[model samples]
Target: MSTCGGEGPEEREREWEDAAEAVAYDSSTWPPPVVAVCGPGNSGKSAFSRLLLNTLLGRYKKVAYLDTDVGQPEFTPPGFVSLHVLEEQTKDLTMLYLRPPKRCFFFGDVGAHKNPKLLLSYIFGLYDYFLQELYCFNETDDPKKSAIPLVINTSGWVKGIGLHVLSEILRYVSPSIVIRLRTTSEGKNLPDGAFWLDVREGDSRVNIIEIRASQNSPRHLLVKKEARMIRDLRLVAYFRQCLPRDFSVFSYDDLVQGFAAIEPFQLPLSKIQVIDLHCQISDDAQHDFLAGTIVGLGSSKCVSLSTECPFPWCIGLGFIKAVNIPGNFILLITPASRRLLANVDIIFRSCIVAPTCLLQLQVSDEVDDITDRLRDL
Candidate 1:
């Protein structure tokens, strides 16, 4: 079906109303804003996602970027959503593609926007989950109801229906940040609430920079010059759920040791090593690995993508060509994948893989210290 407006005006209005009525949380009790970014493919959702984290990290120690694009997840570990205090993101250093310091979580949703059946399913599933957990309409353990600042990177398949859906999504998305690409013609007219500084392809550099200059709030924002770096070896943990049925390769000793320290989605030790990729880094590998790899929560059978997955059990993801073992160059299996390719040179960039620990921010007293540090910036 074409992604265009459909049905009668009355029906359309009714559907919109139904959608609006569905999310009826009290304003005072509603969770923090969940920001989602949607634009045509190649509009640069990935790089901009980092911009969101980089800007917020100045204010927050921990932040999360969730990739709901499904087909093309941007924030995997390693080269993909690589946010480790690898280097400082400052005014002097900020460029088109600069590495960021600080540990922010990146998760990519497998069945994101392009897949309507899957997308709608998850949406309804989330709604049901929200009702069960928050509304208590049923007895269930649904965590989507939990309040967290969620940033959804959407898919780009332009059409009226997609735009309509995009608009509807915006209604639900109380964005603390939003980045949109203006065309060469409208580049000069880029409006408020959009974070992208770079103008569109057809846009002249003059207007683009002007639009960016308007967003000069980052000047006062604290930029960490020397940030701590972490590399999470636990990224292998995502393989359990994302990988396929009969595919795995792992060291018995390493598996045992890794699981001892951090469990890989409770994978049965017996089922380990089914998906073998020959190359295995030592457990005590020098740095945090999360920066350059995908980490999923429920799965532990991924091939390690260049970014991070949201669930923590990644099950599957892809990595750069250099990281792949011989023979299976363009590999895909457990820790299976969505093949969104990037330029090769960016792979060598530093990664942050250390596991993150959440400090309670709801408590004002303790959080005051962190806030004070930020205000000074």
Candidate 2:
């Protein structure tokens, strides 16, 4: 929410306007430009992406946002790769997290290091959906009503396998404008040039722009939020809404305490099916593995748990407070709407876990270590 230069709101508008002009100067010719914002951590990618989105709103009715940064998603909670079609203009991108995503995939893990291929597949699948279902190529239907432009916000790990993932994304999405933010530190910059073009040939030329990190932006990558704190805040913000609206008079401690006192929603284990995408565990151990963990609730068309179910359409996520194999029941805590939760038939043991801060009894730093080990399974 912080902007560099401490400039007035009007001054900031001018800055984004300049960038937008460069990208969409000829609206008729370059109607909807697909832009991907990428860089190392704390390089102001999120802020810049918002600025670009705001600028584009002046020209386009809607802008499609493909959030690939599961560790610190701009719109949703951590551990999801989601695609949201932005219809309303947002003042601050961070302030737009209240709504659920139009579509999302639960990757379970915070980062793609463990399963880059699956992450890539999710991104590609979302993009394909956008192109096939959302995009409007015909000029007759009304250019003003055409499919929204896409802006991709990537994770900051732009080195090693991270860089490779970004490269592969560029090759796959083929955004018309690629905005790469570079911090003062040269080492943090992504390799110079259009790296995605190293071995691949594209039908169109890709425009690459490198920008410096904002001067007044918070030092989130290094100091302000250490990854755990960011994730904790995201989870807290999400679950805090589950409380009754009249029950708003409380401090964070009071909220956490109140959350713990509430009886969890119980689901019969017989009617629900559990699937783990990353590892294979025996049926006997499935309940044990799911207990005291965060899992995604979804509805799948498949009938049998004997074979792999198609990728589920996640309706919501919940923390498993207790699992009783003997009783064939699971106690869960989640803030999702009751209507959506009613249709839940499948549960995914994903990489996502409630932060230790949100847990009733946990040390401040225990979740990072504990979640790492759990995700590795």
Candidate 3:
């Protein structure tokens, strides 16, 4: 084994451009090119995927993105595996803006180490949906003109069970191209060649592109504190939808205050069922446990709550401000419109939680005055 000198940012950028161009121009893949970007944590998988997406958009009218990184998803919030059809190019690669996915499934947790099977099921479902709805059945002499190419942005978990999950995804999707970003830290990089395939598989046709990961990348080191802050910021941004477009929130503290003052929607408890995906809660303790927690608002055909119930279609997420057991109603805050809310028949609670700052209220005098006025009303 030999080691080489580190490459500069320019060289890395060039390599990324070359890889993206290759995927965009590759004519061999029949059902439009399906590209998968995979690597260990903080290895620039998301950055490369975005570049590939932008590059592909230059040639194809529309490209489908399958985001499997529930911890830090590209389009939707954490705890979801989603597919988005992007017709327009991403204006700024640095901006972390949220977009509604064409289809999504909330897995209720950030990492798949606990429930890899469930995560894989959701991912497979999304890929199948993309094939059926977007890619397959669109026949034309010029495949590029009709068929939408898919770019799969995978999770950073590359060792142990994470690796197993990645292998399953590769086997199932069998993408035309697999780009693995390599880091100088050999321990942090995935195994060479088709790491997902077993020795018996023998000479897979998947075009493998290996590029040295950029050291200049800000996320090169997976710092827990930084990662947690980023997740919290993303959550804040998501919930900020509850505010009016003209409303200004200049800082995190301001956002917290805004959330504290925002009026929440009240829903009759009888109309909706609640299920805890992570664990079971006693009937008496359900309300207390749910208060101030973030939950998935889903539409389900089943009226009763049961572990056996099939996963529902997640309409959006809501923050359970209060669970008024006495009133037989719940106060929730969400960005989902009333039209979408009307179909929400179930609430799924997962490991995802509202940041502590958002929950702790330092009531301002204005808020107190408003409360008194409301009470008088």
Candidate 1 lDDT, 1-377, residue by residue in tens: 01113355454334333322222222432343344555554444544455555554444334444444434444333322222221233353233231221222222322223334334333333333333333332333554333434445665543454554454444443344344432233332234332232334333221111111112123222322211121132234333334344444465554433323221121222222222111234434412232223322223332223121211222224321112121112211123322312111111112223232211102233234434554677
Give candidate 1 regions above 4 Å deviation. 1-33, 77-114, 123-148, 174-177, 185-314, 317-377
Instruction: Give the true-structure RMSD of model 3.
Output: 4.6
- Which residue pairs clash within candidate 2? 108-351, 108-352
Comparison by TM-score, 2 against 3, better one: 3
What is the TM-score of each predicted model, taking all chains together? 0.33, 0.82, 0.88
Instruction: Please give, for residues 250-306, the per-residue lDDT of candidate 2 as tens digits.
Output: 576777676775556768788898888677577678888886688888877522221
**CA displacement after TM-score superposition, residue 334 of candidate 2 (Å):** 1.8
Give the best candidate by TM-score: 3
- The order of the candidates by TM-score, greatest first, is 3, 2, 1
Clashes of each: 73, 2, 0
What is residue 308's positional error in candidate 2, in angstroms? 15
- Report every candidate's CA lDDT: 0.33, 0.73, 0.79
**Which stretches of model 2 miss by more than 4 angstroms?**
1-17, 93-96, 139-145, 199-204, 215-225, 261-263, 280-283, 302-310, 361-377
Q: How accurate is candidate 1 locally (lDDT)?
A: 0.33
Looking at model 2, residue 220 earns an lDDT score of 53
